[model samples]
Target: MVQNPARRTALADAAIEVLAREGARGLTFRAVDVQAGVPKGTASNYFSNRDHLLDQTARYIHERLTPDPVMIAELLRAPRDRDLVKALVRDIFRRISEDRAGYVALLELRLEATRRPELRARLTEAVRDELDANVAYHLGQGLPGDRETVVVLYLAMTGLILEQLTLPEVLGTDGLTALIDAIVERIVPAA
Candidate 1:
């Protein structure tokens, strides 16, 4: 197996694009190599098997989706109020919107996971950990709202991102930012 971290990341990212564009059925080593502009079998060199490739792709998506610490720090400096929650939610939405491919690939992974118990378990654990980490971060940072609030926000944002990506028409233009504001204003307690 290849020992290059950069090469592995490239293959994983290419796999993400393949998944987003072609779904699980189309994610082959050759397809990843083509997408990554690498020689044939390059993906196979980095990943032992299809499941291994899928697992690494999932990890890469999570790594890309995590918020930047500098951005988080900048946002955290704001008042710990519902407004802060709104800002954070907005940032989350922005990140997802910017990385549409990664988010879409993640959705594909979710679908693929339904047919593979091992993948399902891994995704479940990863998502739960992310949720817990967000909750912990919120509490540790003195942010308004509790675990319930974060959970609700997570669900709401997930739905919003899904709709926005798959069918923007479902959420008319007027209801976009206004809707986010409403969610935070109602769920996040004013401090």
Candidate 2:
């Protein structure tokens, strides 16, 4: 259906809230409407079905995230070294910890993808594109090595993020910063 960008964004954001709080099964059209404080059929008008709503929610969350340009610029001004990598990692983890539900929604999408092959392929492609863009971002900064190094760093940071989000206490109160520093030192080769 044709909807204004603002209206669609609002509906998708509301749908994300529903997905985060109630999981995929509970993300009904009425639920999104209620969450958005719009009329009962508003979300239905914007989205043809639950799949449309869910896809929009996933995309909305991704659109709203991605490291801030200003933050990236500021980081770029700093020396390209281990500390810089730590700063970037810390920025990522900080954002993740702040928007826990958004990450939860993404994780839920991953789980739901297992049962939906089309969604799995779509999400895998989307994630791969993002990863490639990330590699380019790293190389553009004149960071050492190739995409493979960045990919390895991505995996390590992902594990740390998973642990931090799911079990912060497991990191032993050293917190995101210290853990971030450790990973940057260990995984990121000196440039």
Candidate 3:
């Protein structure tokens, strides 16, 4: 099948909107078609099934979340250890804030993928790759117990964001940053 990049892009964008607004349960071919301003047949033509469409959407979101080479270089080149952690935390918070909808959609995808083996494998692999990369980056910089530290920090950050999202009054941005800072302090130690 000839790949129409424009149509694929349109479908993926529409899928994000639908997933964000109505969640995984509300995703449908007709809804995507309406959201994308394309016919249902056209949307289906690009993604033959719901699974195919959702898988593509997951890939799209993962690509967006993965840090690029320039971002990696900037993180690696930061002047101080604290600065490195701060930069990483700041970037995560920025992404979470700027694309709350997308993140929420990703959460939905994770939940849905539990029932679909292929999707579960793909999402799991992507997440593992992300975590491994983070661990390797810190280890390369001589951070202590880098793999375990990254796992702990990553979990803490994700948990904090989830709490902040669900209970904004209790976990404000400043409080979240403080929590992140405390975690980083424990992991990186003072020089």
User: Of the candidates shown, which would achieve the greatest lDDT relative to the real structure?
Assistant: 1
TM-score of 2: 0.93
- Cα lDDT of model 2 by residue, 1-191, tens digit: 86689989888888777877888778899998899999889888888877777777778788867889898898889887767877887888888778877887787888888988877888888889889998998888887667887898889977876776668778765655776787677777888
Q: Model 3: what TM-score? A: 0.86
Best-to-worst lDDT order: 1, 2, 3
Better of 1 and 2 by lDDT: 1
Q: For residues 118-156, what per-residue lDDT tens digits would candidate 1 score against the true structure?
A: 999999999999999999999988888899989998898
TM-score of each candidate structure, all chains considered together = 0.97, 0.93, 0.86
lDDT of 2 at 78: 88
Instruction: Please give the distance, in angstroms, between residue 79's alpha carbon in candidate 1 and its true position after superposition.
Output: 1.0
Which one is best on TM-score? 1
The local lDDT score (0 to 100) that residue 20 gets in candidate 2 is: 77
lDDT of 3 by residue, 81-122 (tens): 665776777678777767776777788898888888998998
- Scored against the true structure, residue 188 in model 1 reaches a CA lDDT of 85
List the lowest-lDDT window of 10 residues for candidate 2. 171-180
lDDT of 1: 0.91
